[model samples]
Target: MYETIKWPDEMKPSRSPIHFTNELDVAASVETIWSLLTDPKAWPSFYPGVQHVQLLDGHARFGAGTRFETNLAGQDVHASVQEFEPMTRIAWGGYPKAAEHSRAYHAWIITPTANGCHLWTEETMRGPHWIELAKQAPDIYWLTHEKLLKDIAEVAVAREKSGA
Candidate 1:
C-alpha cells in the first residue's frame, strides 16, 4: 500500500506543460476497480482513447517494469510500469514511439472508504507534442479523464450487480 503516489521530477505539474487529474468515489470494492485497471485487454471496452493494447512483457497483469503498447493520442505509445502496489496504487510513464520529444506519466490511487473505494488519477505530460495538443484544446485531457472516471465507475457498478 502507498501513502501517496510518486511523481517523477520531470513529470511534475510545475515542470510539465500539460497535466490532467480526475477522481471519483465508487461504492465498489477495491478489487473490482483494480481488476478493471490492471487488465489492459479490457481497456478498449471502457477507455475511449485507447485501442489495440498489448502487453510487451509476458505477464498477464501490470507489475513494476512491465511494458505495454497502445494507440493513444493519435499515435502509438509505448509505456512502462513504474510504480505498482496491488489494490492501492499503479503508475506508468509512456511516450509515443515515433516521437522522441514527448513523455507522460499517469498514476492512479485507490483509497478505501466506508462504502468502498475512492479512486484518483492524474497525468503529467511534457515536450513539443503535448504543447501543440494543448494549444488545440487546453482542456482536452481533463475532459477525457473525467469521462474515463465516470465510465469506469459505471462499469464497476454493473460488474458488481452481475457478480462478475
Candidate 2:
C-alpha cells in the first residue's frame, strides 16, 4: 500500500528528536510527480537550496539502493536509498558530509486519487545539530518541506501543461 511513509526504527517518534510530515494533493498524474521526485538531475531546477547534485550509482533515475550526493542549503548531503517501490513510495537515509553525526531519513508516498495523487513526505532527524535546532527553530524543517511540496505541485502542473 502506498498510503503512508514507513519510518525506520531509528527515525521512529520514540527515538528521533525531530520528525515532521507534509502532504499535498496535487493536480497531476502519479507518474509526473514520481519522475519529479526521483530525478536527481532535475532537483536543482525546482528545489531551492539544492545544487551540485549527482547520482552515485551511475543511474539516471532513483531505484532501490541508489546512492546520491548533493549540496542542500549549503550543506553536503550523501544519501542511499533505503526503501523503494516504483511510482508509489521511496525513502532514503542521509547524513551531512561535513557533519556525519547529524543523520536523517526522508520518505515519500504518492497515492492515486480521483483528481490526481496525494503526495506525502516525512522526514526524521537524529543527532546533535537537529536536536539543538528543534529546540531553537522548531518549525524550520516543516516550513521548508511545505515550500517543497508546493514547488513540486507547480512543476508537475507545468509539465502537464507543456506536455513534457
- lDDT against the true structure, per candidate, is 0.86, 0.84
Candidate 1 lDDT tens digits, 55-164 = 98898977889999988777799999999999999999999888757999989999899998999998989888878888998888888888888888888889999999
Model 1 misplaced regions, further than 4 Å: 1-3
The 10 consecutive residues of candidate 2 with the worst lDDT sum are 1-10
Off by over 4 Å in 2: 1-4
How many clashes show up per model?
A: 0, 0
* TM-score for candidate 2: 0.92
Worst 10 residues of 1 by lDDT: 1-10
